[model samples]
Target: MMLFQHHNTGIHLDSGSTFHLRTNEDDFKEGSLQGIHGGFHYASNVKGRELYQEGIDKVFDSVCKLDTRASDNVNSLSNMVQDGFDVFMDTNRENSFFVTRNGTTWRFGHHCRVPQKAED
Candidate 1:
């Protein structure tokens, strides 16, 4: 959501224009884990559910304010937040979401976390 706020038009970082750097899945998931790891809520708890809904609402409201014309579709900021949250909660380390100057493009990708073993 913050990325869209800064780069609503989605320009490439190397285009000589300033834009937020993309976050890989590993880093993003790790950060999110660190943020909520101390919490005592699991998926079945009322507090966990409340916190989840609160986060969704906050993201929705923020996106609405930042991108006035966006909607709950793939091309909209709100949906991006929704999907990102889902992926994060699922601990999906293989998928990453990013935007490009070309437009809002959500692509599935993988981040290599281990070095390849060469055959002897």
Candidate 2:
């Protein structure tokens, strides 16, 4: 599955890494994951996904200065592991992003990349 990284946002992380990306638009797909599927023994995308998510958060924090502390990023993320989706990651487990069981739905956690906050 192809993942669409958001461009045109000029997103910059606090670590100074610019969010550089591109898409076919006509053939672009978006999701929360990347890398190889390691069954249960491997979970690379999970960590990589976290870093990607963190980078995104840093970008938002940097570009918008919305450095609000998350009360349960880990808990929410942990729960997602049970959703039965297949997760993939790089060899180093740095970008262990998520991929759906159908091999279609890809993207960072909905909460991680999405800009809107649900109402309390």
Candidate 3:
């Protein structure tokens, strides 16, 4: 599990599975892992609301892409997003949720129960 936090914003990653060794037969000499399951949460003051919401929108978009590509399985990417949220919030059930990818490029998605307030 990896956790990164700065002030009221934080990210938590839980690599659920182990890395598998890949041989030349698979075209790679080194081993590779699949992906991560995690969640992100942020709280900002009123002054930072616009920027924070923009960030949240980006995350939400990424998750939607992952969900579309994910298969119907317990360990699917969408599930990973939810799992990450559960872990980060330390709750067994749902809360405000966001999904993000790791590495050089990043993407995100969103799932939230509460209605977002209108922009000023």
Candidate 4:
């Protein structure tokens, strides 16, 4: 699959943005795969989730960040390192999600939760 990052928004690139150039958001629709979003978690915690989300977000999966135009979200994210998330700092926003088309099927990253497997 092709891998790259959006120039402006800095969102991760995947097979979805096959022909995209500018990246304020996944504004251009590249078939049905344009909306595949959030499939992983940051240690399943806020900080871990946020950075990890940011790490690969803009370059496998296509996810966005919805937060303060200034500082609130960043500050909140900092607190999450120690105290974890409060009521307001709920997991990332759904708006940052993405949709993508893969062949005859559509793959949604955020929508597809990683499977749970228990082992001894």
CA-lDDT, candidates in order:
0.24, 0.28, 0.24, 0.25
Candidate 3: global Cα-lDDT?
0.24
Off by over 4 Å in 1: 1-33, 37-40, 44-102, 107-120
Candidate 4 Cα outliers beyond 4 Å, as residue runs = 1-29, 32-38, 43-46, 50-120
Instruction: Tell me how many residue pairs clash in candidate 2.
Output: 19
- What's the lDDT for residue 53 in model 3? 12
Residues 4-101, model 1: lDDT tens digits: 13223231212221211222222222223222233322222122221111111111121211111222111243344443422121235334344332
- Taking every candidate in turn, the Cα RMSD to the unseen true structure, in Å, is 16.9, 17.1, 18.2, 17.1
Q: Write the per-residue lDDT of candidate 4 for residues 1-120, one digit (tens) a residue.
A: 222232333322233221122222333233323322553332212343222112112222322332222121111222222322222211454222232222111212333332111111
Score candidate 1 by lDDT. 0.24
The TM-scores of all predictions, comma-separated, are 0.17, 0.26, 0.15, 0.16
What is the descending TM-score order? 2, 1, 4, 3
Error of 4 at 99 (Å): 26
